[model samples]
Target: MANRTSRDVLLRGLWVLGQGIREQPGLFTVGVGGSVVFGLLTIASAYVVGAIVGEVVVPSIESGRVETGLLGAGAAALLAVSVVKVVGIFGRRLGAGFMQYRLQASYRRRVTRRYLDLPMSWHQRHPTGTLLSNANSDVEATWFPVAPLPFAVGTVVMLVTAIAALFATDWVLALVGLAVFPALFALNVVYSRRMAPRQVRAQQLRAEVSGIAHESFDGALVVKTMGREAQETARFAGRAVELRDALISVGRLRGLFDPLLETLPSLGTLAVLLVGAARLRQGAVSVADLVSVAFLFTVLAFPVRAIGWVLAELPRSVAGWDRVRHVLTATGEMPYGDTELPAAATPASLVFDRVWFSYRPPVGEPAAPATADQSVDPTAVGVPGANTALPPVLRDVSFTVPAGRTVALVGPTGAGKSTIAALAARLVDPTAGRVVLDDVELPRLTAGSLARTVSLVAQVPFAFDDTVRANVTLDRPGLTDEVAWSALRLAEADGFVAALDDGLDTVVGERGTTLSGGQRQRLTLARALAGQPRLLVLDDATSAVDPRVEAAILAALRNSEIATSILIVAYRRATIALADEVVYLDQGRVVDHGTHQELLARCPGYNDLVTAYEQAEAERERTRSGTGTGDSGGGDPGGGPARAAEVVA
Candidate 1:
């Protein structure tokens, strides 16, 4: 981003202030009105000094009399001035509080809404720390301008009013005080130029700190297991130190600017006093007029100081507003079709037509074989790249899940099985292909229509920090006990849920940490089953379940009325044997596809892979039985029996 000039910062700050008022006009009007009254009262207090001297002190000295009536009336008038001063103070504080509160509340909500509306690809580029800071600190910074804006405006009004009164008493003194105006504005511009880029850097560093902290916390388990606590802490501390330095730089500049604003009004008053003394000696000005002019300049100091406050915050406010606007106006929004999916009268038959897809690397990451621009459709009318070095994840892959038939996708790691499942669920769009469900293209279906038509249960599932029931329902309207219980039973989670202390209402810790790995997996499966989507997808969703238990769950799914077609990403024989057909994928291509037994007989690659998987499973079974029987020295102290089994495989 280009460095913002002083004028640009001030203009953007003003725009943010105007936007706040537009959002809450009534509150803004009340706040500004109060500040104006407050400003007038502050100036009036200065006038009372001249009033007391001119009206009571002058006459008493001339007459050489203790005039009780005159003295008593002056005291009464002073009391009235005090009362107005108190009211003005209250109004100014009230207005500033109101506007600040409204601005913070409105922007926080807007930032959250924008995050939800942004596409997943955009989210992939931005970290949790950036989004969190945008919602919290950036929002607060955007509203900081609101705190000083109204008071600053009122001060300007009071200064204009005080000057008119000053000139009415004596022209020369008023003119001397007016010189401070341009000088004060000049000070503000200089401060903005020095702080604008620094404040922007400061805000970015704050997000960096937040991101590092969040990463450390999120990966706490991994760090703990790897015994890398010092490494993680050092990573976080590095960013924290940088953020501290940035904030100090901005603070140092502010320190210099604020005092100068404060001292100028005092300097103007001194200038007026020198001129007024000479004018009084010439008998050209009365003591009362000279006193009034000097007092007015002293009163003007407050507003001048407030103007400094507004200017000091402008650069940070501009930086924050720019970040917020970037989010609101972000491009790459996933455009969905207007058409809804056809009603459930037709079977949900899924097909991938000569499909091709690939992923582009994020900024600063090593470039992937396929660049983003190279993600152009291979099927485009005039383009050609049916075979590029950047092999499409699902290169010219085509398959069909006939109505009511289950298909199992068996493949080595990175064979694009999960990618294919994502396409079927419409979580992502294919770069050069059409994924159709029930004869309708996947992209043509509205979000809601696609959601009900198919449901995907990811390999690693997430549970909200809420009750088990809420996690499944997502608090969706119209979810009933029967529906939830049936899904749980099919997922083989009913037994464990019934055994829990609080049943369905029990609160699950973040990511269901309170639950065992297999238990969390089952709960995730139950969540998808609860919705009873027409087409269900499982991407290694049951990998953690016990083999015997997994068999029961697969049996229940095969016999269930809810899903007509199921797309399973599987490696286990029990799972693949249950499928009506199998698709064998090797290095992203579908090598051969048939029933489990047919593939084992005909496809050499499929047989070897499955045999390897079977041998591995057999080793795991032997290790578990040996551990139970107190063999192998009653299990190794390293705490993972699977490591030994993996070595054997």
Candidate 2:
């Protein structure tokens, strides 16, 4: 059984190589043709040397006189063969390198494109670190064997031709050639079998180590702030040590077999010489024949090792191919239709018709019942399923934001608010029912149509390491500086932006680290606004800004000339009151919907939730004012009587 498994692995590795050859047949042909030229010349060089020794040198020495012309011809033949051999080596190396790099680059693009095509739910099930590994190191490993593949193939031709030459000269020497070659092949097969599992283990460990390191670095702030740097370092080091040991195991196996592979060819040359001497005495072969065969074996040592080089790399190639195939063949790609929405400058109305959604359990995990109020764990987002065992996060929820109006989604933490926002933006599809925009189902519209019509600003702002103009415009065509400035003004971010050293040209650093939290939030909001989206979903996007700034930004968006419908996941009473209407949610169900005053008067849940939020806001204001460190005149420190009246009326 073990032998069968080893054979299967070897065959699979060969299959991967075959796929590569088929994919780039032109380059493979060019590489192999050059190698074959080198091989044939190698055989010719051996014969030429043998001929020179038997004909020119031996005869000149026997006669006790130098033949200058014949010596010069022999020298010219050797030099000419050497020149052609160099040309062949250059072509072989060039072709092999181009083929390998091109294949790696192509597959990396394909993997990255696949990542973009997969839905948010699919991305949630995978780690960013693992995805990066799959695109980079794994793709590199899959094509690693291509470097030596041509040389190995050429060596096979050389082996066959040399064996025939041996038999043509002397059948007894042919028998020696046959024995040494088979032993060499057998040793390589054994080495590959022993090396495969170790190579595969090492490849897997590389990805794990990358994942741990990325996590540790990505959360560096958390690690430092929580004083868990030592724990994080230990976690990273533990995986790094495993990867180190795995690579060492691979190296040890290669180290053991390399010398052995080298020794087989030397032994073959020894056997040829021993057998040739006996043949010379028996008159079974001429001196020239014996010399040629012996010289062939000596030169064959390095070329024969080419085969071992290829076989040794096969395990790693197979491992990388398997990993790449996982991404290429992954299920749950979100499909889009060709339908396009009609172009309109007016706001697009959004509606949820009995929409229900539940997070599926990850593969092989039995789902446990959980409340809608329970927080989502980032690591456990699951694969798609037809039905989930856990309770739905949103159950028969229905609401609408009419065109040219603002609707506030008022819910306690984790009442599926963000999920609803995602649904509205078509970042995800509801498991049951549908979300419609402008009277069209989201899935039926083309991706471009959906993108043009709606934009989502996530709760946590993200910015690329780029100029302010680039971050706001996102390189989208036609979003000139004028448009970016307008959006920044609408988001209440233009003042600080104008004060920057280079204005819009200044680099923001990674994830906008050079900017304050409020500044980053405002910048991201401006980015969304610059898209000129008809329906905008803010998943508590302005939480980092001062409450007064947040309220002013909302008011500007509500009164903007461009006309957009807004769905905001809001917590502050002031922001909620700014909405044209409020949807009160409790435990994933819509408890009520009405104007702020109507809900405050009629619904106890709404009243209690708003009162708690008001108290929290008042406490934060008191702390800020007492410390004398708050933004000057930012919010009403006494929880403004006018806003309270608006809520109470």
Per-candidate Cα RMSD to the true structure, in Å, reads 4.6, 5.6
The true-versus-predicted C-alpha distance at residue 373 of model 2, in Å, is: 12
TM-score of predicted structure 2: 0.90
Global CA lDDT computed for model 1: 0.77
Give Cα-based local distance difference scores for all models. 0.77, 0.85
Q: Which candidate is the best by lDDT?
A: 2
Local error of candidate 2 at residue 384 (angstroms): 6.8
What candidate 1 gets wrong by more than 4 Å, as runs, is 1-4, 57-79, 338-347, 363-377, 380-391, 613-649
C-alpha positional error of residue 87 in candidate 1 after TM-score superposition, expressed in Å = 3.9
> For model 2, what is the C-alpha lDDT against the true structure?
0.85
CA deviation > 4 Å runs, candidate 2: 59-65, 362-384, 388-391, 598-649
Stretch of 10 with least lDDT, candidate 2: 640-649
TM-score, per-candidate, Cα-based: 0.88, 0.90
